[model samples]
Target: MREDLTFTSGGVECAAWWYPAAGATTPAPCVVMAHGFSLTREDGLASYAEALQAAGAHVLVFDHRYLGDSGGAPRQRFRAGEQREDWRNAVAHVRSRDDVDAARIALWGFSFSGGHVATLLADGIDVAAALLLCPFSDGVPRVLASPPKTVAWLLPRALADMAGRHVTVPVTGQPGERAAMNLPGEADGFAATVRPDSRWRNEISPGLFATVAAFRPVARASRIGVPTWVGRCADDVSADGKAIGKLADRAPRAELHDYPGDHFAPFHGELPTRIAADQVAFLRRTILA
Candidate 1:
């Protein structure tokens, strides 16, 4: 069953969906999840959460503050540090639930949030397992992937936003546009994940560029010290596959899997089911064991 819930993070109330484990007679393993980049919970996350719930794991899918149904000001802001704190609070909320097994909790993240999972684990969140899909492991590659012209166009706006101008930019756009992600197919890939009823916006604070430039989760991979499953999109342009491979190698007990298509592939069409099944199998051997 799915129930709407809210949790506090950084003094803001964040919205979430709670999927109780089916037929659980005792405390059950729970997977804590959130969306990537400027996306919200409704953007293709329910499928995986439902799959995990069906496999007897409680699932909690939440929206980061300032996005989706969450309450926060200066909407569409995306801050890596604050988002990580939201993940921490979400895990803490799950652990407080009487029906959840605190010791068997797992962290699930996609794209940008995927990097958050690694950082959280390295920072010692005490989770038992982690599932990352097309994670943005290194910002250097991401910045390098952008066209020089795009970078030149975005930098000043990003700096202006950082200086309190609050400049907003499209999260994705045509190849020649001045947006965060404009690589061929990236805009369409992101659009495919948006549900018809989604409240997600296509704009975000330009300051996100500054955040991505300094965020490198791959550097902390070795400190994760937990069973981690890293799913890489073989053709991803948004998140560097080579950096993802490095993350898998550095993570003490990580298993790396390659999927077809680009960054958003695992969340679209038949891939979501297949990918969720693979993740559930991993959980079966770890969190749900």
Candidate 2:
């Protein structure tokens, strides 16, 4: 079953769905889940949360500061730095709960924010495990590898975003929607799995475009002491597989699972449920070992 959780961070009200374990009467290991860029808590995360919860773990799936049901000013804006704080705050909030095991906190991030988990680990979050799903490991390399034409159009807005203190860009659309990841195909793949009744898309801050240039989570993978599981798609064109491989190499304790599909397969069709099951199995071994 699922439940709603509301917590305050930096004076902003944030929301998450807590999936309680079956027959769980006391505190259980918790999985804190977040979505990728242009996505929200409703985008393929609840399935995973429920899977984990069914496996005797509590899953905390939340919307970021400016996305979904969460409270934030100037909605749809993306702040990489602030997102890191949100992750930290989410974990803290979960820790304070009586039904969660504070010492067995794990993080699960997908697509763009898969890279966010690495950043959080680098910042010294005491997490027990990390499950990354098609994460963009190296932001700069991934960004630079994009079509130069696309980058050119985004650079100006990126620059404007850097100086404006708050930047906004259409969440998804044609080629020029935003400079960050989620090009046309990626955007469409993400949109395909939404819950239909949710209003989870809009203009993300141009600040996200600017921030993408400076974010590099792979560089700090060596410092991520927690157990890590990276699930990648062999046919994923949105994220650099080589970059994911490189980050996996740097992680002290890491495992890589290559699936036979594109980026969105792990979140839709017959694969999502399988992927969620696999994720739950991975977390169980890591947290209970």
Candidate 3:
């Protein structure tokens, strides 16, 4: 059964959906999940939630504070620090539930939220497992890889954001346009990830890129000791494969799997099934065992 729910985080109400496992008697294993940058809980994450539920795991998918059905000031904010804290609160809320195994609470984060998972694991949150999908782990390399002009324009906006000036900007746009992601096909690539009936938007706080440039999770991967799974898109332009490989190499318990597409590959059509199967197998052997 699927139930709509909400939890208070940082004094804000965060919307979420709880999918209980079928035929589960005692508390079943649970996986806590959230979306990527500029996306919502229902956008392309429902399929994965269903997949996990079918594999005998309860799933909790939530919208971060400033977007979707959640309540927060200044809509469409993409602050990573706030989102990380939201994650901590989400896990804590789930741990208090009686329908799921508190000791087996795992985390699943895609894209930007992937970095959040690494940060949580580094802090030694009492999670049993974690799965990061095509993670945007290192910020310096990502911002540096952008076109010279895009970087030039965003630097000033970032500065203004730091000076107490908050504004919303396109999260994805065409080349030469001012946006957080503005490569040649970035707009289309991100659009392909959104599901129908989703409440997500293409705009977010202008300061997020600067915050991303300074964030460093891959460098801190060695500190995460959970049985983690890191999935990579082989030809991804959004996230660096080398950085992903390094992240897996540094983590003592992380297992890396490579798929055959870009950043959105694992979530596209039949590919998502393959990815989900891999995750189910991982859990079956580790947390679900």
Candidate 4:
């Protein structure tokens, strides 16, 4: 069963869904999950959470500050540092629960937040394992891949947002558009993950460009000492697949899986189920063992 709840993170209440492990007799392992850039827990995370819960692991899926049902000002603001803090606090909250095994916590992140998992591991958050799907490990490749015109159009808006202006941009659009993710097939792939009842907005603060460009989670991969499963989309245009491979290689105990299709492929169709099966298997071998 699912329970809607709130947890304090960064001085605000972040909305979350807690799914207790099915028929667990003892304190069970827990997986703390959150979505990628500009998304909420309602977008496409419930499937994975339910799968984990069915496999006898509690799941805590939450929205970051300033988005979805979370309590915060300046809605849709995406800050990597603050989001990481939210992840840390979520872990702490789960660990404080009597129904969860404090020593057997795992972190699950997708797309942009996949990088957050790596950074959190590097910072020595006492998690047992990590599951990263289509993680944006390095931003340089993505910056270089952006179309020249899109870059030009986004630069001014990014600058304005950095200079205290509330400039906003589309999260996804047609190729050559000024949106943050505008590669071929990206818009459709992102749309496929959105539920009809989801309250997710397409707009995000333009300052996200600068944050993403400077963020390089792959650089800290070698510092992660726990078991990590890195799943990459072979044809992902949103996040660099090659860099994700390097992350797996650099991480001390990481296994890499390459799925078919683009960055958003794992969120829809039969792929997500298959991926979740693989993840649950990994969790069973590691945290839940």
Candidate 5:
């Protein structure tokens, strides 16, 4: 069963989708999920949330302030700091619910917000546990290292943003037209999992590039005292796998799971379910212990 919910953050009402644990009556452990850059709460999160709910955990999946179904002006504008606040807001809302155990709450993030969790840990949010899926940690370095198709448009756009110029880059054009971050196989990767009706494809504001460069989560990860798990797609070219591995090494309590596939493959092709299972099993042994 699923329900719609909302919470206030930074004076804006943020929206979220909630999945209740099967047969759950009393308060239960809950996982609050945050999505990656340019993705709405429904893009690929529903699968994981539903799987976790079936595995006996409540799930709260929310959109970032300025993206998707959430409340925020200037759609698709990326703000790392504000997004962090949104995570805290989502957690607080989930914890306040009558059917959730405040002490047993877990933070889940993928890609962009995957790194956000690291920052949250640095801030001492006190979650029972945390999960990172193909997270991006050092944005500045990664953006610089990104392919030209990505850097070409993203860098200039971010610069335009710095000068207070609102630059709009095309989301895509030709069949192989790049969407800033689509690597050699990324277009195909996106096509595989994204439904034809999915509207997530787009060129994010150049401001997003600026925010990414200024964001750094790896340095703060070591401060996390909660048990942490990092899942990686060994073949994920979109995200910096090496940096993710480093985050696991830096965290006080951490483990790494290297799945055998590309980034989106793990989101589909038998991996999302497997990853969910691993996440639930790990939470059971670590947080539920």
Candidate 6:
């Protein structure tokens, strides 16, 4: 069963969908999930949500504050800190639900939110388990992967945006375009996951770059005490494998899985079918068991 819902974070209402497990008993264990980067909950996450639900875990998928159907001002803004807070608030909202089992709460984060999962665990939040898929874990590696000139060019724009004279830039662009994540195959990867009715924006306020640059989710890996699973694509250009691996290794109970395809592979087509099986196996062996 699926239901629509909302919860407040930072004084803003965040939109979400609650998927109850097919054969769930009352107070089912729930997996709290959210999109990454400039993504909305509508962007091909339903497959993942459904997969988790089929495994007998309730799924709660939501949009971050200021994105998608959620409430916020000035729109299309990205802040790692605020998003982490949103994750915390989301989990709090889940606990408040009478239908959820607070003792079995879990988390699932995709792409950018994957890193956020690390932040949540780092903060010592209690959860039965967690899973992060194709997460962008480190900032310096991403910046180093981008063109030096583009990084230099964006610094001023980022500063300007922080100062409230906001400057927006395309998230991905051609080689010489003034964009933030304009790297090889980046545009194609983004295009592949966009659903037909997606409301994701191409442009975003750049002030978050400074925040992103300072975010090193891996640094807090050692603080996570719950069972965890981390999935990564071997050739993922959008993130650093070493960083992700190190984070997984640092987490005392983290398991890492490497897939063959690129970053977008798990989000589309037959690949999701395979990835879902792996994720379900993990949940069964760890949290849902």
**Residues 1-289 of candidate 1: C-alpha lDDT, one tens digit per residue:** 7999999999999999999998899999999999889999988998899999999999999999999999898998877789999999999999999999999999999998999998988898899999999898999988888899999999889888888987788999989887889999889987888888898999998887866767899998999898999999878999999999999999989999989988888877798888999999999999888
Lowest summed lDDT across 10 adjacent residues in model 4 is found at 205-214
Q: How displaced is residue 63 in candidate 2, in Å? A: 0.4
Evaluated at residue 271, the lDDT of candidate 6 is 81
| lDDT per residue as tens, model 2, 190-225 | 567677867576567665555675677888889988
TM-score ranking of the models: 1, 4, 3, 6, 2, 5
Q: What TM-score goes with each of the models?
A: 0.98, 0.93, 0.97, 0.97, 0.90, 0.97
Once fitted onto the true fold, the runs of candidate 4 whose alpha carbons sit more than 4 angstroms away are none
For residues 106-134, what per-residue lDDT tens digits would candidate 6 score against the true structure?
Answer: 99998889988988888988888999998
Q: Give the TM-score of candidate 6.
A: 0.97
Q: How many backbone clashes does candidate 6 have?
A: 0
* lDDT (Cα, tens digit) per residue for candidate 4, span 112-217: 8999999999888899999999998999999899898888898888888888888788988988776988989988987888888877899888786765677899
Q: Weakest 10 consecutive residues, lDDT, candidate 1?
A: 206-215
lDDT, candidate 3, 1-289, per-residue tens: 6899999999999999999986789999999999888789877888899999999999999999989999998888767789998899999988998988988989999988998899889988899999999888898888777988887877778767767777777888988787878866678887887778888889888777666776778889999999999999878888878888888899999999999988877767799999999999999987789
Give residue 225's lDDT in candidate 6 (0 to 100).
91
Worst 10-residue lDDT window for candidate 6 reads 260-269
Where does model 6 exceed 4 Å of error? Answer: none
Which candidate, 1 or 2, has the higher lDDT? 1
Looking at candidate 4, what is the lDDT of residue 6?
94
Native RMSD of candidate 3 (Å): 1.2
Q: For candidate 5, lDDT tens digit of each residue in 149-221?
A: 6666567777886677656554333334645565567667656656555556465565667567667788788
